[model samples]
Target: MTDAPLPVRRALISVSDKTGIVPFATFLAGLGVELVSTGGTARALREAGLAVRDVAELSGFPEILDGRVKTLVPQVHGGLLARRDDPHHMAALSAHGIGPIDLLAVNLYPFEATVAEGRGFDDCVENIDIGGPALIRAAAKNHDFVAVLTAPAHLAEVRQALMQHGGTTLALRRRLAAEAYARTAAYDAAIARWFSSANEVAFPPRVAFAGSLVQTLRYGENPHQAAAFYRTDGRAGVATAEQVQGKELSYNNIADTDAAYECVSEFDAPAIVIVKHANPCGVAVAGTLAEAWDAALRCDPVSAFGGIVAANRALDEAAAEKIAAIFTEVVIAPDATAAARAVFARKKNLRLLLAGALPDPAQPGLAYRSVSGGFLAQTRDAGRVDAASLRVVTKRAPTEAELADLVFAFRVAKHVKSNAIVYAKNRATVGIGAGQMSRVDSARIAAWKSAEAAKAAGLAEPLAKGSVVASDAFFPFADGLISAAEAGATAVIQPGGSMRDAEVITAADERGLAMVFTSMRHFRH
Candidate 1:
């Protein structure tokens, strides 16, 4: 049986966001519904020439603690929590002169915004709405007899219900009740996150992650799995990006796009990173985005097909033209020129995203991963290596050109999967082998790919010839370094903490290759 609509004889509205309060209150008043509100809401209704009874007048108690304890009084809670079906509850409210509140409209203060604005601790603490949450919970618990409004966006539905049924349906009340509880949970989560950050607590006893639904994807990694994208209030990556054109982003598209964007952001100069299967297939830094795109694609043209491309700088017509020529899945950048956007508009199915800003590679943040029963949390890998930090292990030090390529290759390896091996020449990835079972196998695979790429480009020599090789971690054995030497790599860069470091250094010296140790490992597993 459809539950009968309950008449809204009285509504207690206290809103921090007064977007449609006046009009909504006016509508309620027109329906002969008594408008009882608190503080600024009552003042707003009165200013709009509507009758409103303040909570102070209804409770017969003055708002104390600078309005903090205004709605916390028993009269307000009793009216909200009372059950109309329960005689004892109705009798208690009547005995205390507390009329039942049929409707409640409330939105919490701007605590999240205040924290995002980098407000002081005191200011942020003051913005936490204690009374608002209590009132929302009370009304939500008694949702059987009450309708709750958590946002201004819900006003229209409530207004329509009042106009058609002269009250709210039980279904609408339950839905709004769910939304109210979710809003309070999200608000409290934001507060908890901010408090932990303020106190420098990396991992708290309890953690709550909140996200707003951005879009429901057609499918996940495959067609059988369901998926949706949710946005958190952190980072300027794919989550916060604006899609200018093309079809909606898929689950795999978003994942690869984020990987490409994060890899591209590692470089300061004009750079392009092409990612496939959430791994960087190719990466290059050049003087222009067009040049970077060409070099990056040259690394693994086969893999670059239908891959996600990311650029560190704004896209120009030249870069856009080059990227549009291929069957790319998605292209993301900080911005794009109008001419570039026009070029991309031709590709109807290609997704183009502008993130507005690039994420800071050095910024401190947390990374989370799920396991069987629990999740793992760790700080983001913001570690970087420079020329000054490099310790030459071989007798012959790397030349200035080799040093530049070494650093470049190591940065690329940081983004590559574990057992990663990257070969770089002139700040462009020549070959990359990632997520292999063995480091030696990764080196051989990278060398083989370099030769294949060279053949694809119709070059006589392999791209790894005279290039610098970088390993994400130390060489467990000398075989990996030997493989790089055989591939014609003249310099090597690795974390250099292996027990067989001496043997690896000996092998590099024997191959007449320069080797440097970063003393910092980057294992992206």
Candidate 2:
């Protein structure tokens, strides 16, 4: 009812994570505030030579059921939830010998950490705090009269406010109450997700997801929108990479860097992938990262400029020197040598990220996207094909070299946007066309790109000559296949599940091209 600061007289402190708890309680006690705590916290405060009152003593009842029913009594909630501005609330407190609790500092059990550590089910269940969330919610619901702290980070701010205003102000109480509710909500979401997984429920009737804020970006995709980054999964990649040097990464940089890293991780050999606007401009595998870079950059030199580059192995000085020669925005790898770091230091504005390790390409995970009213969730695109999985659908079978490039091109096509077309020779991409409405248009665009790259390199012939072509989905008509054949593609690989599959195979055989069908379709959007 009023915007006045309330003086703290009685404060309760209980925390599973005891970081900075003793000093915080000591500060509160110095202000002549009574300190009431529970089991381990009370013992800790007493051992620190601070006088403390136990919750059992305040409620006049002993803790039972392994301390599960300690602070759930009416005494605790009545003190936290009662409205101090009401005459009836004061009368009820006076009639029951209840003292108003002005401040509550509590942190829930380490359920998230327990699950992350792969602990046993019983241990994880035991770590779930029962009384902590109840206290937080009650205190937050009565923010006009009560203040609650959910994390140790909140202690410093509250301590500062108390020192400045001589207590917690109404504004500070409202802010802390909002944060308290958010912390509890995220905690509950983690528990719900874990339960769904443990029960083998692939798609639960009700699902919850939570994330921790990693940073606040300067802008979103453009300068007009605001955005922030959050970490939801623990898989290693751009989200978890450590920046060694350069300016702060933008939203586009993070997205493009993630795409490049995921594309590179698909290869076991030393590899490099160059991505621009979240699509792979080039990708290659070789004996060394330096060689891979050269081959990958040769795919589309014009588009490789200012692109995000990802390497599957540790970066050496040779590779770093070559990458630094180009105007690259970001370079990500598992690790870097000292000489490589020195080479990158000259380009102060180029971001260098070391991810410690590459993410597993075949690991089972979930992918989510926001829709109009809700979100869409599905399993990650981890399907892969090998030489043995290929079915020869043409008169002539592909040569050994063509077979290897077919698999390589299909893998790169998996990371490209659909309708996708990729042309690869040896182990490197020569041309890539993505996100077109018509498959024929994508094939034609890829051929044009190959010709432009060849002209830029002063070569008489385009790199797509004798290369293998891969399609992300089944070809609805034979026109796309004809385009590849006309571009001098000697072999083709695609998912065979369209109504015009017979017609397409007839066209491939007539063109004297080797074609194979992979039952799996990789349609990335």
lDDT of 1 by residue, 1-525 (tens): 248999999999999899998999998898889998988888888999999999999989999988888999899999999988899999999898889999999999999999989889999999999999999999999999999999998999999988898779999999999999999999999999898998999999998978888999999999999999998877899999999999999999998998899889989899999999989999999999999999999999999999999999999999999999999999999999999999999999999999999988898868889999999999999999999999999999999999999999999999999999999999999999999999999999999999999999999999999899999999999999999999989999999988999999999999899999999999998
Please provide TM-scores, in order, for all candidate models, with all chains considered together: 0.97, 0.96
lDDT against the true structure, each candidate: 0.94, 0.94
Stretches > 4 Å off in candidate 2: none
Q: What is the lDDT of candidate 1?
A: 0.94
Q: State how far residue 87 of model 1 sits from its true place (Å).
A: 1.8
Model 2 worst lDDT run, 10 consecutive residues: 202-211
Among all candidates shown, the one with the greatest TM-score: 1
